[model samples]
Target: MLTHTKFDSEAIANHITNWLHDYATNAKVKGFVVGISGGIDSALTSTLCARTGLPTLCLEMPIHQADSHVSRAKEHVKNLQARFSNVSSEEVDLTSTFAHFKEQVPQAGTQHLTDLTLANTRSRLRMVTLYYFAGIHNALVAGTGNKVEDFGVGFYTKYGDGGVDVSPIADLTKTEVRILARHLNVPDSILVAKPTDGLFGDDRSDEDQIGATYEELEWAMQQNDSGKVAADFTGREKEVFEIYKRLNTINQHKMQPIPVCKIPLNLT
Candidate 1:
């Protein structure tokens, strides 16, 4: 049997509307620019931005973004535009840029660096495109990271997906995001697609990368929050908990503002 949890859709809408308006007004931002990957996270973000009556620019940056994914992204944006005003969409081909860079630095020689560098390059390139459009349109870049991905596992590249003026859904857990998406009437195709960074192949899922399901991870986080003793964990459970804790600790910097040391006037 399926279980249901109650969520205040009207409350969420009001909160997001207020947030978008305040952010744009205070920062003098004209609108919001989002990189829509035809994934749930981006689609949800773009949807919220559009619903706020803000000019939302959704860019499809398919570096390694799949053809099927690209088609869904276009369709999602088209659907969004039909519901909201001032919603503009475009497709950008980043395959050529990625290919040129790959040729410049032969990936055959550097095994690990090739993947790491290329993955991060794709993320940063998307950010660069978002910010470039933001600059031209006087808009703020809206981040699409959900709390589970951002806080629990630190599953994003620093200064890549991390660089944004405002994050709308950072407080919402992966489960909570699905709830909101459903409430907002997000399409089933997007709501059910395998969660991925789109930096790798089509089959590369977030759960595969993290080595744990969101259900398990969320349960672990809930357990940790309840002040439960470590004695409750068994061998494999303990190991998984340790891994999650380590990831959270190591990526704590991602959760904080960049450090700035206070300089004393008396110091020479």
Candidate 2:
């Protein structure tokens, strides 16, 4: 059962940090590199990385970022740098870079696909930037995805935010992330701020796109995991369950390994 393990925030935090340090050490990397998107997931991920006392480099790659996102990212980076000497930050404004790429790509697709592809492009560009720094500094690209986003709804962009050398928080639920963020003393601004992917320039929220809140999504995920079906749920629960299932089904490609067609020995 999901509840088999009781929620001990401190122990969980320590465990994640220990795992991160061990992975980096075993890999012989100097430190970790993370894209700070001014969301709770990234905030918590970067904080956990800092606790390891490893050289953590936080990248604020804003491609037409909202002012609020920019402020919070800068705020978190400053606080982290002040708290940890090993923490450092560099801002790579990718607005021009994204525009340049758009100039070269075709735009004959539907408006919806065009918009989504561009947003995914933003994420992929940031991924490239993260690895660029990782290569130069010999650091791992730490992913900032939580369990719900990573597995439940598959809300993240594949080969974009989903791309990472190490995922420190992908196992933690969104609610658990908030609890641990409080425990970590993440700034009140970030703690209370609405969760947005910040991929679009506007301050739209993840819920705006998902049609359900994280709390509801988490509940739906649990019910689905326990073999609960549409017959078991009513009203909003049913709606959320359906939404969860739809996304999970469509995004199964992202959650699973790429399909490989193996040639038989006869063909060989």
Over the stretch 1-268, how does candidate 1's per-residue lDDT look in tens digits?
A: 1133566766886698689878898887788999998788888898889877878999889886777688778878988988987899877888898888788876646777778778888899889988999999999999999887777778898888988888999888777778888788788888888888888746578877777766666766666777754578888677667667777779888877789998898995
Whole-model lDDT values for every prediction: 0.82, 0.92
lDDT of 2 by residue, 1-268 (tens): 1342478989999999999999999999999999998889999999999999999999999998999998998999999999999999999999999999999989856998888889888999999999999999999999999999999999999999998999999998888999899899888889999999988789989999999999889888999998998888789888989999999899999999999999999988
Query: 214 in model 1: Cα distance from truth in Å?
Result: 2.1
- Runs of candidate 2 exceeding 4 Å displacement: 1-5
* TM-score against truth, every candidate: 0.90, 0.97
How far residue 256's Cα lies from its native spot in candidate 1, in Å, is 2.8
Task: Specify the highest-TM-score model's number.
Answer: 2
After superposition, the stretches of candidate 1 with alpha carbons farther than 4 Å from their true spots are: 1-6, 106-110, 228-231, 261-267
